[model samples]
Target: MKLLVTLMGVAFITLATQSQSIYSLNYTMGFGVGETSDFIGSPSFRGVTFEGRGFLDDQFSLGGYFSWSTFYEKLAGEKFTDGTATLTGTQYRYINAFPMLFQAHYYFGTDEYEPRAYLGAGAGAYKMIQRVDLGVWSIEENHWHFGLSPEVGIFYPVGMDSQLNVNLKYHYVFGVENSLNYSWFGLSVGFAWGD
Candidate 1:
């Protein structure tokens, strides 16, 4: 993660030295839906994301983002037989995830206030914690995995230095085991500012 951030910093400096540029900060709120959600038995996982990017030109930009999300669910109380012992109770399941990525974007537009669209892809790491709790016993696991995201979106200019940003991205994480794979689709809305 530190290496990815360092590489992005180098790219930003390299780009800034070459042309007139802009910088932006954005916040996004969204829901996580898919295999990871299914694994936790909940499809309403909530996420918060923060990102910063440096635009070297009208068509190219580079940045990094950090996001966190949690998926949770509760199961009704029940009794089960575990070998010779019988266990009874309600259970809770939760999964927390943190993702950090380095991204590059390509925009299709002609001017600062003109409407534009972009396509981008990012690669990095994801840290996840999965846990299950019963009245008397609990289990928890953590893992770090390689991940990738592909995104598409539109930017609606709102001012000389700002725009409303909306996007959808597909996220995939390679798991230790095939069944541990994490896949989800996310949608977000935010704003970007430049100077």
Candidate 2:
């Protein structure tokens, strides 16, 4: 009975000593580099990211994140079939994507005032807007797919309640029709605020 009481006291003390941040909000803007398999040109993409996290413990956090990115490519004389005729000309292709995900993050090391590293993973919906322009004519389509993202990053303490954030992530969308599956490597830098 005495041993059980001692264990309960220790557990209470441990819980009381763990300090956690109430909430964290982060925003970043950057670019992604990748090419689609079916596209005829080498394309480039840019993105904006936003995240809001709540600390579950001193080292663990969970959050929801959303990002928007646009991909662009220009193709010269790409051939396509139109009924009984074949057409070829300069083509401009654009793909816009928005991903909303639920993320889990694990922060490593115990230094709150020093640079810290973290790894995270998320899965959610990816909404896509696809467009093609052939000078006088244009075609457009929209889709929604399931996707996942894996990330690694650093948090550099800049002030008492703010930090400089940098990260790299790989996003992949699955089960897309017409082989419109998308993937990219994203790099971003921004600021985070919390306790």
TM-scores of all predicted structures: 0.78, 0.76
Give the clashing pairs for model 2: none
Pairs that collide, model 1: none
lDDT of 1 by residue, 79-139 (tens): 7798999887888877777777778889998676888899999888778777889887898
- Please list the Cα RMSD from the true structure of every candidate, rounded to 1 decimal place: 3.4, 10.4
- List the candidate 1 regions with Cα displacement exceeding 4 Å: 1-34, 78-88, 177-179
Segments of candidate 2 deviating more than 4 angstroms: 1-45, 77-86
Each candidate's lDDT (Cα)? 0.72, 0.70
| Best-performing candidate as measured by lDDT | 1
Please give, for residues 18-96, the per-residue lDDT of candidate 2 as tens digits. 3544233344332443445365244344667877666677678766667777777788787889899998899998878
Give the lowest summed-lDDT range of ten residues in model 1: 22-31
